[model samples]
Target chain A: SAVISQKPSRDICQRGTSLTIQCQVDSQVTMMFWYRQQPGQSLTLIATANQGSEATYESGFVIDKFPISRPNLTFSTLTVSNMSPEDSSIYLCSVVGTGPLAGYYNEQFFGPGTRLTVL
Target chain B: SQQGEEDPQALSIQEGENATMNCSYKTSINNLQWYRQNSGRGLVHLILIRSNEREKHSGRLRVTLDTSKKSSSLLITASRAADTASYFCATQNQGGSEKLVFGKGTKLTVNP
Candidate 1:
């Protein structure tokens, strides 16, 4: 299992301001992804962060609003730009762990989410 | 639209009893995973059941998958108060390499 950590566990930001959340993994991982979970809702993948390439954003999410940085295999950052109340959600990062083994299922380990509250 | 949907939004069970939560997903999936979330914090991966495998177990957790019906279930036997948390089901969609679609999750309350 990999130990993952996020910075600024919880923050309250202004509606027009921006906040950046950082995710760091203990070991090098092949895949790192960003997800958002609104109050009482399920998780929605924001994007897949590539180590050296522009992130592949999911529909309705753009690079301008959610700029992601994958500097290395073990580190990634997600910044919520021009934030609004709707952008207030728990931002989580997950990485694929050792798997697809005997059971042929790859597991993902998530970091303690950075909760952003837009006021 | 979301891919997987969990049933019985909330459930309350007595300690030492069994708790079951079901998830239904649309579309072909390569694998289905169950995760536990404490409060609104990070999610802990519980168990994963492959598309070909019908069931898998880990400790007190048992997960069953039915590719034919696009549904999966998680059963926690003799659950305790520490087991009280939100359980989520995530699916790795077929044709989609690493994208995981997560369902709304079921809140399970185990009372002492």
Candidate 2:
């Protein structure tokens, strides 16, 4: 399985401040996805990031509020802009592992996630 | 948005007992998967059952998908204390893409 890491394991920011969460994969992958888990809620897909293209955001999630960037196959960043208390949630990024021997061939390996708290 | 709901939002059982969690989704899926997440950690993929398949097992975990009902169930047998975690069911929407839609998950606590 690919080794995935996310920066700023956690952070506390005041309202209106923006925070960028970074996700890095040890190996290059074709698709990287970002998901958000609000308190006591299910995981929601924020967007899908493909290298060298604009991210495809899901319904109820806008580019202006949650922007994403994929500079290469091994890395991506998700930024939460104009944060509010409701924006506080655990943000996670995952990648499809390469090769059949990597974990479950069809499974996604996720980062530990970045916990954000907005006051 | 989430794909569907997981029943018995929370469950508590004794070790060595069998724990079952059911998931219901809204759309056709190419495949349905079960994942386990210990508190404060990332999710770990458990098993995946394709739409064509009815049941699949991996060690202590057994998953069944009923396409007709658009529902799935995950059974963990011989549960141990370490089996305590939140179990989520995710599905790849039938559009042929691999985007996964996850359910709220069932929180299971196996006591020793």
Candidate 3:
């Protein structure tokens, strides 16, 4: 199990503004992911942040809207650009530990989310 | 696109009773994992059941997987008020990079 923490647990921002959330992990992890959870809905993967590489955004999400920077193996930042009311939701960061196999037994550990409310 | 779908959007159960939730996925997976999220908190990993294994248990939680049917179920015995939370099932797609696709969760409310 990993101890993950996210900055700005809750924030209220005006429309058109941007909010950057930080995620820190206690230990080094192989893969880090970002997800969005709309109220009363399932989570949607936003992107996968790979250290020293560009983040891979999922369909319907782009780097322009959500820029991600993974400086090292234990830290990453996600900036929600040009916030809108529709963008208000909980953003969570998840990581998969280095397992015995390259891709086997991949269990995700999530950070305490950052709740952003756009007014 | 979502791969898993959980049954019973919501459930209310009395403390000391058992709570059960089911999940169905679209494709074969390496493993299926269950997660629990308390209100206003991050998701906590509960248990994981591999495709080759039929069942797995941890503490009071039990998970069973049926690869032939592409479905899984989670059972919580002796529920308590603290057990009130949202439960989700995630499937690890076979082959590709190990990315997990999650399903809409089951909101379980254990009333004391």
Candidate 4:
């Protein structure tokens, strides 16, 4: 299993400000993704953070709002731009496990998550 | 417009009892996965059942898939208070970039 960690476990930012959440994995991973979980709602994919390339965003989400960067296999970052109360949610980074343990299911390992509160 | 939908939005059970949650999806899938989240935290993968397979088990978790009905169920035996959390079902489409469509979760509360 891969150990994933995210920076600034929780933060409060003013509207119109941007905060970058960092994710670091203990080992190399094949695929990295970003997701957002709103209060009392299910998780939604924000984008696929590809290594050394632009991210692939899901519907209703765009590069201008959620910019992602994956410089290497072990690290990635997600920046939530133009903060608003609606944007306040839990941001998580996940990686596809490639080792023997996770091969059967291709299970995803998730970081602790960054709880953002936009005021 | 979510791909998956879970039934019985919330469930409360006594410890040592069994808990069952059902999920239904719309399209052909490569696999169905079960995940658990506690107190609005990151999810933990519980188990995965492939499209071709009917059932899979892990520890206290049992997952069954019925492709004909486009549904799946997760059964947890001997539930514990620590097992209280929200459970979500995710589907991976037959052909895609490994993205998962999640369902509205079933929140389980086990009373000790």
Candidate 5:
């Protein structure tokens, strides 16, 4: 398993502002993903951040709203641009551990998460 | 798109009892995994059952998968107050897609 950490554990931002959450892993990983969980709801995948490449977003999510950057294999960032009250939720980053087959049933390790409260 | 749906949105059980949660998915998958999440915390991976495997156990956790029916179940034995948290099931397709689609989740509250 990898030790993951996120910066700014919790923050309160005004509407229309932007917040960038950082995820750092102790060891290098092959894939990194971003997810959002609304109040009392299941997690929704926002995008997959790849080093030195563009992010792949899920349906109903766009790059303009959630811009992601993965400059290296061990670090990634997701910026919630132009925040709104609806954007208040828990943002998480997860990475797949280095296991046999490199893409097998390897478990995913998650960061502590960044809690954003848009007022 | 969401691939799995968990039954009994919420469950309340007394400590020392066993807790069971079921998950049903829409499409075929390579494996199904169970995860636990405490309030205001990140999810912790519990167990994973491959499509070819019918049952698997890890400590107090037991997971069973029925690929033919596209469903799975997670059983937590000797539940404790510490087990009061949300449980989710995720599916990974056989197509080698690293992405995992999760279900809504079952909020299990093990009362002390």
Candidate 6:
């Protein structure tokens, strides 16, 4: 199992403001992803944080709204730009561990998550 | 393009009893996985069952996959209060992106 942590555990931002959440992994990982969980909803994949390249966003999400950067194997950042009340959700960072179980299961390990409340 | 759907949106049970959650997905998948979330926090991966495998077990957690039915089920034996959480099932498509598509999830409340 991999240990992951996120900055700004919880934050309250005004509408139109932007906030960037940082994710750090204890070990180098090849696949890192960003996800959004709205109130009373399931997790939605926002984008795939690719190292040294633009993130691969899912449908209904764009770089303009959610910009992500994976500078290295152990770190990534996601910026919520021009935030709105609808964007108020729990943002999570996830990565596939390089443990012995990796061969048996490609399960993902997630950060604690950043809870953003846009007022 | 939601791929998975979990039924019985919520469940309540007494401790020591067993709890079951079912999930169905559309399209062919390489593997199906179950995840648990406490409150609104990050999810914890519980177990994964590949398309080729019919069943898998990790401790007290049991997962079964039926590719012919495009559905899967998760069973927790002797549930405990600490097991109260939202359970979600995710599907990894046969090809393309390695992303896991999550379902709505079933909120399980194991009362002590």
Question: How many residue pairs clash in each candidate at the backbone level?
Answer: 0, 0, 0, 0, 0, 0
CA shift at A7, candidate 2, in angstroms? Answer: 0.8
For each candidate in turn, the interface RMSD (Å) is 0.9, 1.4, 1.1, 1.3, 1.1, 1.1
Supply candidate 4's per-residue lDDT for B2. 76
What local distance difference test score does each model get? Answer: 0.90, 0.89, 0.90, 0.91, 0.89, 0.91
Superposition-based RMSD of candidate 5 using all C-alpha atoms, in angstroms:
1.8
Give the Cα error of residue B108 in candidate 6, in Å.
0.4
Q: Over 4 Å off in model 2, which ranges?
A: A100-105
- Superposed on all Cα atoms, model 2 deviates from the true structure by an RMSD in Å of 1.5
lDDT digits (tens) for residues A16-103 of candidate 2: 9999999998887767999999887778999999789899998899999988999998899999999999999999998875653254
Q: Candidate 5: which stretches are off by over 4 Å?
A: A99-104
Which regions of candidate 4 fall more than 4 Å away from where they truly are?
A: none
DockQ of each: 0.82, 0.70, 0.70, 0.72, 0.75, 0.79
Q: Going through the candidates in order, what fraction of the true interface contacts does each contain? A: 0.80, 0.62, 0.57, 0.62, 0.60, 0.72
lDDT per residue for candidate 6 within A8-83, as digits (tens), equals 9999999999999999998888789999999999989999999999999999999999999999989999999999
TM-score of chain B of each: 0.97, 0.98, 0.97, 0.98, 0.97, 0.97
Q: Give the per-residue lDDT digits (tens) of candidate 4, residues A1-119.
A: 45889998999999999999999988888899999999999989999999999999999999999999999988999999999999999999988866532566676667888999999
> Lowest-scoring 10 consecutive residues by lDDT in candidate 5 chain A?
A97-106
Model 2: fnat (fraction of native contacts): 0.62
Candidate 5 to truth, TM: 0.96
lDDT of 5: 0.89
C-alpha RMSD for every candidate: 2.0, 1.5, 2.0, 1.2, 1.8, 1.3
Give lDDT tens digits, candidate 6, residues B1-112. 5688898899999999999999999999988889999999888888888889999999999999999999999999999999999999998898866788899999999999
> Which candidate, 1 or 2, would have the higher lDDT against the true structure?
1
Instruction: Name the runs in model 1 displaced over 4 angstroms.
Output: A97-104
Kindly report which residue stretches of model 6 are placed more than 4 angstroms away from their true locations once superposed.
A99-103
Candidate 4 CAPRI-style tier: medium
lDDT of 4 by residue, B10-109 (tens): 9999999999999999999999989999998888889989999999999999999999999999999999999999999999888866888899999999
